[model samples]
Target: GAGVSQSPSNKVTEKGKDVELRCDPISGHTALYWYRQSLGQGLEFLIYFQGNSAPDKSGLPSDRFSAERTGGSVSTLTIQRTQQEDSAVYLCASSHGGTDYGYTFGSGTRLTVV
Candidate 1:
Protein backbone atom coordinates (compact mmCIF):
# COMPACT_ATOMS: atom_id res chain seq x y z
CA GLY A 1 0.00 0.00 0.00
CA ALA A 2 1.97 2.94 -1.21
CA GLY A 3 0.89 6.22 0.35
CA VAL A 4 1.23 9.74 -0.96
CA SER A 5 4.65 11.34 -1.43
CA GLN A 6 5.91 14.86 -2.14
CA SER A 7 9.30 16.21 -3.10
CA PRO A 8 11.47 19.03 -1.75
CA SER A 9 9.43 19.17 1.45
CA ASN A 10 11.02 22.54 1.96
CA LYS A 11 11.33 25.00 -0.89
CA VAL A 12 12.72 28.53 -0.95
CA THR A 13 12.43 30.74 -3.99
CA GLU A 14 12.76 34.36 -4.97
CA LYS A 15 9.81 36.49 -5.98
CA GLY A 16 8.57 36.25 -9.58
CA LYS A 17 10.18 32.82 -10.01
CA ASP A 18 8.49 29.63 -11.03
CA VAL A 19 8.33 26.51 -8.84
CA GLU A 20 6.96 23.05 -9.26
CA LEU A 21 5.79 20.79 -6.45
CA ARG A 22 5.19 17.13 -7.07
CA CYS A 23 2.86 14.59 -5.50
CA ASP A 24 2.46 10.82 -5.76
CA PRO A 25 -0.92 9.60 -4.70
CA ILE A 26 -1.79 6.16 -3.49
CA SER A 27 -2.39 3.48 -6.05
CA GLY A 28 -6.01 2.74 -7.03
CA HIS A 29 -7.26 6.04 -5.69
CA THR A 30 -9.09 8.12 -8.22
CA ALA A 31 -9.56 11.41 -6.46
CA LEU A 32 -6.77 13.84 -5.65
CA TYR A 33 -6.81 17.34 -4.23
CA TRP A 34 -4.36 20.15 -3.61
CA TYR A 35 -4.73 22.47 -0.65
CA ARG A 36 -2.65 25.28 0.71
CA GLN A 37 -2.26 26.15 4.38
CA SER A 38 -0.91 29.48 5.42
CA LEU A 39 0.66 30.21 8.78
CA GLY A 40 -1.94 29.93 11.53
CA GLN A 41 -4.63 29.56 8.91
CA GLY A 42 -6.94 26.85 7.77
CA LEU A 43 -6.46 24.77 4.69
CA GLU A 44 -7.55 26.32 1.40
CA PHE A 45 -8.49 24.13 -1.51
CA LEU A 46 -6.41 24.81 -4.61
CA ILE A 47 -7.55 22.27 -7.14
CA TYR A 48 -9.06 18.83 -7.53
CA PHE A 49 -8.66 16.03 -10.02
CA GLN A 50 -10.62 12.87 -10.66
CA GLY A 51 -8.82 10.36 -12.77
CA ASN A 52 -7.32 12.30 -15.69
CA SER A 53 -9.88 15.09 -15.84
CA ALA A 54 -9.96 18.14 -13.59
CA PRO A 55 -13.50 19.29 -12.82
CA ASP A 56 -12.56 21.94 -10.34
CA LYS A 57 -9.99 24.68 -10.66
CA SER A 58 -11.95 27.41 -8.99
CA GLY A 59 -9.92 27.20 -5.82
CA LEU A 60 -6.69 28.12 -7.54
CA PRO A 61 -5.63 31.51 -6.22
CA SER A 62 -4.90 33.04 -9.58
CA ASP A 63 -3.96 32.33 -13.17
CA ARG A 64 -0.36 32.16 -12.03
CA PHE A 65 -1.11 28.90 -10.22
CA SER A 66 -1.93 25.62 -11.91
CA ALA A 67 -1.68 21.84 -11.52
CA GLU A 68 -1.84 18.65 -13.52
CA ARG A 69 -2.15 14.91 -12.98
CA THR A 70 -0.78 12.12 -15.12
CA GLY A 71 -1.70 8.38 -15.26
CA GLY A 72 -4.41 9.30 -12.76
CA SER A 73 -1.94 8.97 -9.93
CA VAL A 74 0.86 11.53 -9.85
CA SER A 75 0.26 15.27 -9.69
CA THR A 76 2.31 18.43 -9.91
CA LEU A 77 1.51 21.98 -8.90
CA THR A 78 3.30 24.68 -10.79
CA ILE A 79 3.48 28.19 -9.41
CA GLN A 80 4.32 30.83 -11.97
CA ARG A 81 5.66 34.17 -10.82
CA THR A 82 5.89 33.31 -7.18
CA GLN A 83 5.08 36.03 -4.66
CA GLN A 84 5.88 36.61 -1.02
CA GLU A 85 2.25 35.96 -0.12
CA ASP A 86 2.52 32.57 -1.77
CA SER A 87 4.72 31.22 0.99
CA ALA A 88 2.85 28.40 2.64
CA VAL A 89 2.48 24.66 2.96
CA TYR A 90 1.06 22.95 -0.08
CA LEU A 91 -0.68 19.70 0.84
CA CYS A 92 -1.81 16.90 -1.41
CA ALA A 93 -4.53 14.39 -0.61
CA SER A 94 -6.17 11.43 -2.28
CA SER A 95 -9.23 9.32 -1.57
CA HIS A 96 -11.92 7.16 -3.10
CA GLY A 97 -14.36 10.08 -3.22
CA GLY A 98 -17.04 8.26 -1.29
CA THR A 99 -18.79 8.54 2.03
CA ASP A 100 -16.68 5.94 3.80
CA TYR A 101 -13.22 6.87 2.53
CA GLY A 102 -10.99 9.48 4.08
CA TYR A 103 -8.38 11.59 2.37
CA THR A 104 -4.74 10.65 2.88
CA PHE A 105 -2.40 13.59 2.90
CA GLY A 106 1.28 13.94 2.11
CA SER A 107 3.73 15.66 4.43
CA GLY A 108 3.39 18.71 2.16
CA THR A 109 5.72 21.01 0.27
CA ARG A 110 6.56 24.13 2.23
CA LEU A 111 7.21 27.00 -0.13
CA THR A 112 9.03 30.05 1.10
CA VAL A 113 8.84 32.87 -1.39
CA VAL A 114 11.15 35.70 -0.52
Candidate 2:
Protein backbone atom coordinates (compact mmCIF):
# COMPACT_ATOMS: atom_id res chain seq x y z
CA GLY A 1 0.00 0.00 0.00
CA ALA A 2 1.15 3.54 -0.69
CA GLY A 3 -0.24 4.72 2.60
CA VAL A 4 -2.04 3.36 5.63
CA SER A 5 -5.42 1.90 4.76
CA GLN A 6 -8.19 0.65 7.05
CA SER A 7 -11.05 -1.65 6.17
CA PRO A 8 -14.79 -1.41 6.87
CA SER A 9 -15.02 2.37 6.79
CA ASN A 10 -18.10 2.06 8.96
CA LYS A 11 -19.23 -0.84 11.08
CA VAL A 12 -22.41 -1.28 13.07
CA THR A 13 -22.41 -4.10 15.58
CA GLU A 14 -24.70 -5.18 18.37
CA LYS A 15 -23.51 -4.79 21.86
CA GLY A 16 -21.64 -7.88 23.06
CA LYS A 17 -20.60 -8.81 19.53
CA ASP A 18 -17.01 -8.81 18.49
CA VAL A 19 -15.40 -6.84 15.66
CA GLU A 20 -12.07 -6.98 13.93
CA LEU A 21 -10.63 -3.86 12.30
CA ARG A 22 -7.81 -4.23 9.83
CA CYS A 23 -5.05 -1.86 8.79
CA ASP A 24 -2.60 -2.23 5.94
CA PRO A 25 0.30 0.12 6.22
CA ILE A 26 2.75 1.33 3.63
CA SER A 27 5.44 -1.07 2.60
CA GLY A 28 8.69 -0.87 4.56
CA HIS A 29 7.17 0.88 7.54
CA THR A 30 8.28 -0.65 10.82
CA ALA A 31 5.89 0.89 13.33
CA LEU A 32 2.11 0.66 13.50
CA TYR A 33 -0.37 2.10 15.98
CA TRP A 34 -4.04 1.80 16.87
CA TYR A 35 -6.03 4.64 18.35
CA ARG A 36 -9.64 5.63 18.84
CA GLN A 37 -11.42 8.96 18.97
CA SER A 38 -14.68 9.40 20.75
CA LEU A 39 -17.08 12.21 19.96
CA GLY A 40 -15.42 15.47 20.96
CA GLN A 41 -12.48 13.67 22.48
CA GLY A 42 -8.84 13.53 21.54
CA LEU A 43 -7.30 10.43 20.05
CA GLU A 44 -6.58 7.77 22.63
CA PHE A 45 -3.72 5.45 21.96
CA LEU A 46 -4.64 1.79 22.14
CA ILE A 47 -1.63 -0.20 21.07
CA TYR A 48 1.75 0.06 19.37
CA PHE A 49 3.69 -2.53 17.40
CA GLN A 50 7.25 -2.13 16.27
CA GLY A 51 9.17 -4.38 13.97
CA ASN A 52 9.61 -7.84 15.50
CA SER A 53 9.39 -6.38 19.01
CA ALA A 54 6.85 -7.08 21.70
CA PRO A 55 3.87 -4.79 21.24
CA ASP A 56 2.96 -2.16 23.76
CA LYS A 57 -0.50 -2.97 25.06
CA SER A 58 -0.54 -0.70 28.07
CA GLY A 59 -2.83 1.83 26.43
CA LEU A 60 -5.65 -0.59 25.70
CA PRO A 61 -8.79 0.35 27.62
CA SER A 62 -9.45 -3.20 28.82
CA ASP A 63 -8.67 -6.85 28.33
CA ARG A 64 -11.36 -7.09 25.66
CA PHE A 65 -9.25 -4.96 23.37
CA SER A 66 -6.16 -6.36 21.69
CA ALA A 67 -4.14 -5.78 18.51
CA GLU A 68 -1.45 -7.63 16.61
CA ARG A 69 0.76 -6.92 13.62
CA THR A 70 1.57 -9.86 11.39
CA GLY A 71 4.99 -10.06 9.75
CA GLY A 72 5.40 -6.41 10.74
CA SER A 73 3.02 -5.31 8.02
CA VAL A 74 -0.73 -5.71 8.29
CA SER A 75 -2.29 -5.20 11.70
CA THR A 76 -5.61 -6.08 13.27
CA LEU A 77 -7.44 -4.59 16.21
CA THR A 78 -10.01 -6.80 17.80
CA ILE A 79 -12.65 -5.77 20.27
CA GLN A 80 -14.44 -8.57 22.04
CA ARG A 81 -17.86 -8.13 23.61
CA THR A 82 -18.28 -4.63 22.32
CA GLN A 83 -19.96 -2.05 24.49
CA GLN A 84 -21.76 1.19 23.69
CA GLU A 85 -18.80 3.10 24.97
CA ASP A 86 -16.68 1.47 22.30
CA SER A 87 -18.45 3.36 19.53
CA ALA A 88 -15.94 5.66 17.94
CA VAL A 89 -13.64 6.14 14.99
CA TYR A 90 -10.76 3.71 15.15
CA LEU A 91 -7.64 5.02 13.47
CA CYS A 92 -4.43 3.36 12.39
CA ALA A 93 -1.09 4.96 11.64
CA SER A 94 2.35 3.90 10.58
CA SER A 95 5.83 5.31 10.51
CA HIS A 96 9.13 4.43 9.03
CA GLY A 97 10.78 4.23 12.39
CA GLY A 98 9.39 4.16 15.92
CA THR A 99 7.65 6.93 17.88
CA ASP A 100 10.23 9.48 16.85
CA TYR A 101 9.22 9.50 13.19
CA GLY A 102 6.34 11.26 11.52
CA TYR A 103 3.28 9.09 10.87
CA THR A 104 0.89 8.42 8.01
CA PHE A 105 -2.69 7.81 9.18
CA GLY A 106 -5.59 5.99 7.66
CA SER A 107 -9.10 7.33 7.15
CA GLY A 108 -10.24 5.35 10.18
CA THR A 109 -13.07 2.92 10.72
CA ARG A 110 -16.18 4.28 12.36
CA LEU A 111 -17.53 1.73 14.79
CA THR A 112 -21.02 1.98 16.18
CA VAL A 113 -22.22 -0.39 18.88
CA VAL A 114 -25.94 -0.65 19.06
Best by lDDT: 2
lDDT of 1 by residue, 28-106 (tens): 8889999999999999999999865645999998999988898787889999999999999999999986563689999
lDDT of 2 by residue, 1-114 (tens): 888999999999999999999999989999999999999999999999989989999899999998888888999999999999999999999999954679999999999999
My TM-score estimates for the predictions, one after another, are: 0.94, 0.96
Query: Can you tell me which runs of candidate 1 are displaced by over 4 Å?
Result: none
In order, the Cα lDDT scores of the candidates are 0.91, 0.94
Q: How many backbone clashes does candidate 1 have?
A: 0
TM-score of 2: 0.96
Error of 2 at 3 (Å): 1.1
Q: Cα lDDT for residue 109, model 2?
A: 100
Candidate 1, residue 48: how far the Cα is off, in Å? 0.5
Model 2 stretches astray by more than 4 angstroms: 98-100
Q: Candidate 2: which pairs clash? A: none
